[model samples]
Target: MPQAVLDSPFGQMIMPALSRQIHANKRGGGILGIEQQTPGSSVKPQSQLHHPLAKVHVVSNLAQLDELLAKFQKSCAVIFFTSATCPPCKTLYPVYDDLAGEVGDKGVLIKVDTSQAFDVGSRFSISATPTFITFLKGQQENRWSGADPSALRGNVQLLVQMAWPPHPHQALNLPTFSNPNAEPVIFTKVPPLSKLLAKMGSTASDPAVQSIKTFIETRSSDGPAEATLPDIAAFTAIIRDSISTLPTDLLFTIVDLLRISLIDPRVSGYLAEEPSHRTVTAILAHVTGLPPKDCPYALRLVTLQMACNLFTSPLYPDQILGHPELRRLVTTLVSTSFLDGGHSSVRVAAASLLFNVALANSRRRRDGPGDVLPEEEQVELAASVLEAITQEEGSAEALEGMLLALGYLAYRMPLEGELADLLRAMEAGGLVLAKGRGLGGCDW
Candidate 1:
């Protein structure tokens, strides 16, 4: 929770404004749509224990059980019907929870205390305690009456396998595509700060601007541990104020400064936590609003670089994926940049940003509850990547980046969605095969 500090002779000039801005934006709300709870202030509600993502959901009534079943209609589900006084049922509780955790988003597990939920017991015709039922795609697949842990585990595992069968491609001997690197491609090279700042001319003398320059220079040379952040609030305020007044040609200078500083997690984390995301929003909104043909190449390139750097903070992936306005702007920027044939560097940078976005969404699907990127956006990105690949006759680096980005987006996606259909319609497999032939032994 370290705030970015401003240290310079001009600190006095911006202190009052920064304080006022901070006080004005100070309001009670949670970050990333999750409410922040103070420790020891309140206990979590029992309802939260039954979250969709929780390992085991304890239903209180027939209605609650029905709702959960409806929500997971597309996946495997298991219902544990037990009585409070059933001694045998207690033995399988831990085993059931462990199985739920192992299943993750692939299936749902529900525990119903029939002793209290008499309606549910009646509805399901449960005459015996410790009865278990397995469901696949909403159909009753199997039923048994027991507290045997081995039986419960095996049945649930089998149900999950039935729900999501392994893709046939997994059996292929393509070692190159089996496990593509999940790491995001990032731009970390630091440019000469003194010379870079000189491009700003008189604006470089502004206290906020100078402080950011010092931060980037110190962090670049000595690393983040030795570098204290600049007053990000004040720096952001300056950028906001200058957007309307700064010449279009000169704006990239300030944006490049931010792009370099954002390489540090501390800097990017602060911006990500800002309630309005005003600074980052202002910069991207203005740049992307311009006609693609008229947008300055330097500004566009650095802006794309800054977007990639935002992924440095663990907080930002959620921000980029969950925030609708930000997600749209970023997707637009990336999709358009993919076809920027005039600038291979711009296309490469766009490919890297796309990879970061895909990598974030991929990890969410793998480790968390569900995908943050909507299917429509996924289809749009895949189409753009396909077009880029077909047109890519140069820059192996750019081509590789595009291929990786597409691979992540398509990874584990259900074969029934629009993304899959589009891939089929476009003959994506044939396209990739053609690209491979052109590359001639490129391991890809």
Candidate 2:
């Protein structure tokens, strides 16, 4: 029996007397042939186990029952239909409660006694006692009349499994492998969006900006209902021409707006599939600026964000990597920011961008006749990452990001190559020793 049943006011009045009788029977050498057990030596009851899940709600009225069902309407639910006079219900009560405790966040488990809530019984057309009804996303799924504990457990387990099936990749254990399905960065949090747009003044009324904004809103709300999206060439051209003339802070606003569209395949794919690759060209020119050093903090950060988001579609990064100039521009910007930027946040953002580049490159190599980074490119990036890591003083956040980027860059590189030579050089410089000491919890 459930502990709740034994703790009620009526139960409290009768349970002690019942327990004393049980104890007396045990002292009499057995109850149903079970041996007498001393206090504290008995088996731990299932009720005593920790069950962090929501408890089974015993609803007594139609309103309360409706409210309980409404709470988990979007999730899986199970209701134990019971009545006060049902003998099997009393037998199954503890089992149902235990199942609820085990169900946890996967679904909701509730109990309602038809004897107390006659209106609820009528609503569900309950004609029998101790019925179990299963619901998936507010719709009736399965129901049966009986109090078989194993069947109840099997059904609830199956419902939870259906709702949250295990991921296909969970069993694979590849430490350095990249997830090809990972989407690019989207700036979901638009703080003071109106203010940011207003900063552009009359330029906010530009058709390209308006089109980009509309596309973002539509994709967010309706999610690819349309067969077509805004023209990538037109949007990129407008932004490229405008970026050269915009103020530094406003540059961030434009890039921030543009990054959201990268999640749309129609838009991002244009940069990859177009023969001319005009959008990517515009991006590289805008990011590099007049002189590389002249790139504003806002532009650098937002461009890094854009670069990270480009990973949503492999084509963008793959296309950029195919072109020597574009690849050099991205590598230079990221390396400089990671190595020399005075701002810790900028370094961290740049490190993340580098990580994306390395991950994309690795994924491409694994897929076919692809190259992650050429031997020289790998060595160059690893050196820049190591320099940044060594110079980093106390920011664990930045250090961790740099270390991850380095891991991605070096994980699958040929052991006999330039990257390996670089690692050996780092060992000579005590970098390997520091890492070993750090892992062993020793002061470096």
Candidate 3:
């Protein structure tokens, strides 16, 4: 029942995004795919769940892994979901650690990058970091991959109850999907994790990341930049001096490399792994397009980290902020992050990225040679974030960050009372109620 998700790289890699969509499977075994929703499928949705929080690191060396696991095992339930370039893993991980905290005595939460534990992940049937296999009494249990937190909590509680029965309680129920007015709301679709979902059962050499290779070949400079280059030799070095320790998917590597590279830009132009800033933006454009994939959120977070590392070059973010694709993506992330999602953690993360992007856009506009666009667009970028904050007023995370952004912008540009008024209302006791209630909400 613990069949790993090797056959589906996109599914494996984007499981973090998809993890939130998981359904319970009681017919036994793991909750890996949408077979339950498949046409003519008789197997009812099972009772499996994805509640534990996991920490995943794609390591190529055992020494590093041992260092992490040693410390991790001593702390909590760590199910090491792993695989070679597990693409969907990040989608699932954002909450892996949170879920792990609930699995007391049920297991330890951990992950082993398949590249390092090829045999371990493979032997355990864990073909991806998005994989979930519980550990109890020093033994691993069945593997599952679903996005249902309640189901996961239920199952884990059951496991705990079986080991040490507690007073009987009611089972968790799934949320019902009801049509709201049928008012024709625009639906923003998340791009499929990748074009390789159907190819997971195929060989690892599948043409899943063909674009990645081309991307790297095109954007890659002649060599590394001397400035901010890091000692990520471990990340890029060859394993056993033979096989590439490098990830099979260029996007995965880019995401990871960017995270580390951002800390130091002296390694400038080395990461154009796709060609001009235009192409780099395009690649990430594909990523951000998948708002649910967390690519937009990931790009902004990565941007903040890498912004400092970029040499005096506009090519990178120029393509980014200028790209309608990325802009649209960020907008989607800011607005629907909570509206479209039920998770607070993800909403916070999404809002954080939105705030960063808006600030970056504001800063970029300020740096331009000439003033362009009416004062509206200038304030638009920042105002939208403020609007999101106003909507999310009750949320300390969203309100505080947004209020700060508004404060910073007001100080620099001199608000014409609108921004100032909202800022004051937020600071006063009414912001939270004013949030969803509208500026009209604080009409007092």
Candidate 4:
């Protein structure tokens, strides 16, 4: 017996008279002798298929469709026009649902049964029993008829690809992505060892300090195979124990020796990957606590460079970003030195360090769940950059670096709390105006 035709979004589905169109009622009235290939002429057996990627929302009314469209105005969309009486539509149901699930947040998938959603079907001229329409950024991109599973899968996958092309960072091989065990930065020109030792004077006499200097000199001339690095555990302990008793000048010189020794991956990598991170912590404390005015320009620059060189070990950044005190120390140093235009090199180095920090934060955000840096930390960093930009005394390179640092810190941050305040501060500093002045590549 034929099932009673009732309310359906598909409205009366018409089909060609054919015995092959089995499992369907005979009351189906449409143009006779029309080719079975003329759309809605074939129905394959249904099977269970899983859709784990995304959910296919059933749009019940025009209002629901409008809401979905507006909500995903900036996203990709796939709308499935289905019918109640169309067996071919039912056959393709599993394939369509699976495509939706696979696309996830990258694309919005919707299913509308025309028998129950005539208004939506009429809006898109969807008179056929089963049709699929894809939209990119709220605009209709492609539409096709019939319940061809392969075609449905291909077009939906293509829509997802168009919506989210691979991230630009994937193309960039950044320092943060380098092997943790890779070699450290080596100064191309070696300074005279005698002069360097003479400058250190009394501190050079310390066994641990002297050993570090010897290792750096030997490593530079003879290469990693020939030079033996100092016992890093002993060196770290000695520095920690001796720093308390040392004068500010001697402490600064010792830090410089540590900087030079960092040219060897053995030294820097050990310090970076230490279980307690005591080496980096001690170094940061000494460097940040140094009397700014009394510290020689050379010592200051080397210290900043040493901080930047920490990227040699991939684990170093993860440690730094996760520690509040360490993050504050780096950000404070970067903010202050970046504004010190009188020392262009210091300012630039500071900018570079900030860039690395920002980049690290961005990677953390993308790599997994969890906040890269605390919201308070991001706000503080943003404020520092905003103050520097307001002064506008730095070089273009410094400015560029500062902007990048701010950008990373603000990327994907919630628009509330200090982050919101930071945005307002940036506005007050003429960020919008500056964007209008040819710095157009950034997107909020």
Candidate 5:
């Protein structure tokens, strides 16, 4: 017998005639088990052990497979079909698992043992011991049968590429858009502690207020690591209780105190972890709810600065962006402050706050799958920034901050959404270009 014939599985069974019939059936598209390859196909046989870090879903039945497929319906998926006794199937296990780790949440990877999942085997007509199927957007895209690791990797990569094509913005020559400044623009200047505390009048005597004063003094002199945090619960209560009763002018004093202490991660983290974010929310709500004429300039300025300082804690950014009520109040305050014609400083501080919010949202998009700030809020913010950019004339610092914030918001944003439409409607690109000219050719 020929060596090819000797190496055939049928040779072991001593059933050459049966093997011939199977090959003929495969050529005629009747037998689904055998891999059909072109004469010059690049796929070659290869194998590997299962990868330790790979997160692969091993489904035992059709229901489990269905559930996984449904869960990742919009993403790419690869299903490996194999039997317990198949040696060739063992070879590609590691490659498949490694690919699962690489794909992560971008796609789904599944392995089904045909011996244990007879129903799954029948569902896909997986007759061969080691078969591979790829799905894109819930539809079957391709199928092959083999132990070829290279082929498996190529097909899966191609499916994922088709599922999530690169955004056109990614190809732009804008480096500023690509690399956002992760460091939030914060106001760290500490005014005289005695004078700042004296502004609080009778509240200055409260132990919570006094303790925070010491914490701020120590933090300013020795740095955050050396400073001990004051009682967060008592301080939060002080802010909550004072928001209602404190004279509007003196309210800025307490907020400034909170803002200074918030430079410490411990204080900011405590407020961030609060179930309702009640303390920060109360201050912002009370301040933003006031009519523009009634809201004190000192209070509003300190509030904006306080909002910017919240980003010092890694925990607060997500809460500020993720919590609906807080998100609304913060955005409202920033947007309202954007139109502050009298206080260019207030607008500058507001722009910094906006930049912090956009920076946080941009980081979320970069590190994860979806936008942390909802699309509607993004649209609202972009509109506010664009309006500020158009109206901005005197303060280049405020304009610079607004432009940076706008760039972060627009970076890697989906090109086919309401935001894209709004950008077009407002001719934001032209507005930015005009601002660039006025600013004597800004870098971004």
Candidate 6:
């Protein structure tokens, strides 16, 4: 009976659902003998257990009923259900048992056998067994003849609201900026975007992608010296939201943006919507404009193809060597960076460019057994690299790039004395020497 009462809110209509669960099992409805709860317990209902109803007495004999009602009158509610023979009537007893405190505040639930109290049922017009009629201050207020949990809760909410209204003037705890009156501002820690193909990474079949590809190819032939994108703030907004997700598609877009635009548009380190840059892919790119694709700007543009390798403009290697200006530019940037130690950011960018050019030179020298780089060309490449190391002298990033470039060269050029000495010098720089630093949180 207790199980039925507790579950009644969700399961009173179970008879119908039960028959549906197991086909043909749902013809008629009857009690499954759920456990009953005691009255005047902590298990009292949220509704009415605290209401002011009436109290009514139950007596099996007509003569005894008259005496009991006379003794307790003008009270809270009374709960009188059905006899043992009535299946549904048995379900209410457990409910009444656990929550009898209602007898004092709302009213009392009393059980009476319909067969035993036939004359009483006829007086109250009780047509069904276990019918519940709640009385308030000696007058009936509500009645429930069928079991419907949702319907029951609906009525309960209404009743509870009438008795107690929710807090009227309560305030919500919204975040308040320290400078609430400060000027309205949008954060600019996100990258710039080109409108030619927004959402390019997501819309796989979008028409914009084809249009942009065609535009790039056509422009490459003889369209414009620079394909300018609109200076729209919305593109910035798009990037701000995009980088926060740290989606790989967004990273691909970053790569594509570099490929399409010869210049590396500035990117902010954070988003306006978020307070942190924990997922940002490259801090150097955000702060110093040093993403892999942006390094060529520090070096002059070689031929379009070398420029592409240096990450200036997207061009294949074969096309770049054909241009004398680009070839001279690559040579000049590498030579000057080693000769003059200017800005650290520029130096870092310059070293990377040199590394790539060395690797390219080494590759060109290996095309055939009869081929060897001219002595002057080999000296230009070697001096360019050695100059970078000499200037950085001992910086970590510079040394690392030097080592990588040399290792790449050694693999291709089959090093002898001079190149071997450069390799030893770069190794002696010890770029990977920071392993014994603090174990605590980083300064960043």
Q: Of the candidates shown, which would achieve the greatest lDDT relative to the real structure?
A: 5
Q: Candidate 3 regions off by >4 Å? A: 1-254, 268-276, 291-345, 349-383, 391-395, 414-444
Model 4 agreement with the true structure over 231-333: per-residue lDDT tens digits = 7777777667656766655565566666667666567678766766776666666766665676567656766777777765666777778877777777667
Q: Locate the minimum summed-lDDT window of 10 residues in model 4.
A: 1-10
lDDT of 2 at 145: 86
lDDT, candidate 2, at 351 = 82
Better of 1 and 4 by TM-score: 1
Tens-digit lDDT string for candidate 3 (1-444)? 001211233224333532332232212211111111333433223234333343334455556545644643422234545554565665556555565555532334456676666666556665434656654433444567755556555655554444333211101111110111111111112223233323322222333233333222333433334232333333222211212232233234343333433333332345433343442344344543454445444344443333333322334444445545544544444443434234444445445544444444444323321122234333443434443553463466545545444432332232233333333322322433344243331111
Q: How would the candidate models be sorted by lDDT, starting from the highest?
A: 5, 1, 2, 4, 6, 3
Question: Can you give the lDDT of residue 89 in candidate 2?
Answer: 88
Distance from true location, Cα of 243 in model 4, Å: 2.9
lDDT, candidate 5, equals: 0.78
Model 1: what TM-score?
0.78
State the lDDT of candidate 6 residue by residue for 125-153, as single tens digits: 88886676555445556777754434434
What is the model-wide C-alpha lDDT for candidate 4?
Answer: 0.62
TM-score, per-candidate, Cα-based: 0.78, 0.54, 0.32, 0.54, 0.77, 0.28
Off by over 4 Å in 1: 1-53, 201-208, 229-231, 276-278, 363-371, 440-444
Task: State, as a TM-score between 0 and 1, how close model 3 is to the true structure.
Answer: 0.32
Q: What lDDT would each prediction earn against the true structure?
A: 0.76, 0.65, 0.38, 0.62, 0.78, 0.39
- Clashes (N, CA, C under 3 Å) per candidate: 0, 1, 52, 11, 2, 32
How high a TM-score does candidate 2 get? 0.54
Residue lDDT tens for model 5, 76-103: 7899998889999998888988898767
RMSD of each: 15.9, 23.7, 23.7, 22.2, 19.2, 32.7
Q: Cα deviation in Å at residue 213, candidate 2?
A: 1.0
What is the C-alpha lDDT profile of model 2 across 1-444, one tens digit per residue? 223323434335544544444224222121111122434443322123233456888788888877877876766888888888899989988888788777665577888888878888888999997898998878888999887889989999898766555332222232323344543334345445567678786778888888877777766767777635876677787777776677765777777777777766666776667666655556656666545467667777777777777666646776666677667767776766764447787787778877777777765544422354666666566666766777777666677667666755654454445555545534422553354234322112
lDDT tens digits, residue span 1-444, model 1: 001112322233334543453324233332111123334433322112222345799998978988989888887799999888999999999998888887888778999999899899998999997999888888999999987788888898898878877544333332333443446666788888888778887888999998998887777678788898788999888888778877888888888888888888888899999977888888889987887788899999999998999988989999999988888888888887876789999999999999899888976654535588988788777767777787888888898888878867766565555666556555566677667555543223
Off by over 4 Å in 4: 1-190, 290-296, 339-341, 415-417, 428-444
Worst 10 residues of 2 by lDDT: 25-34
Give me candidate 4's TM-score against the actual structure.
0.54
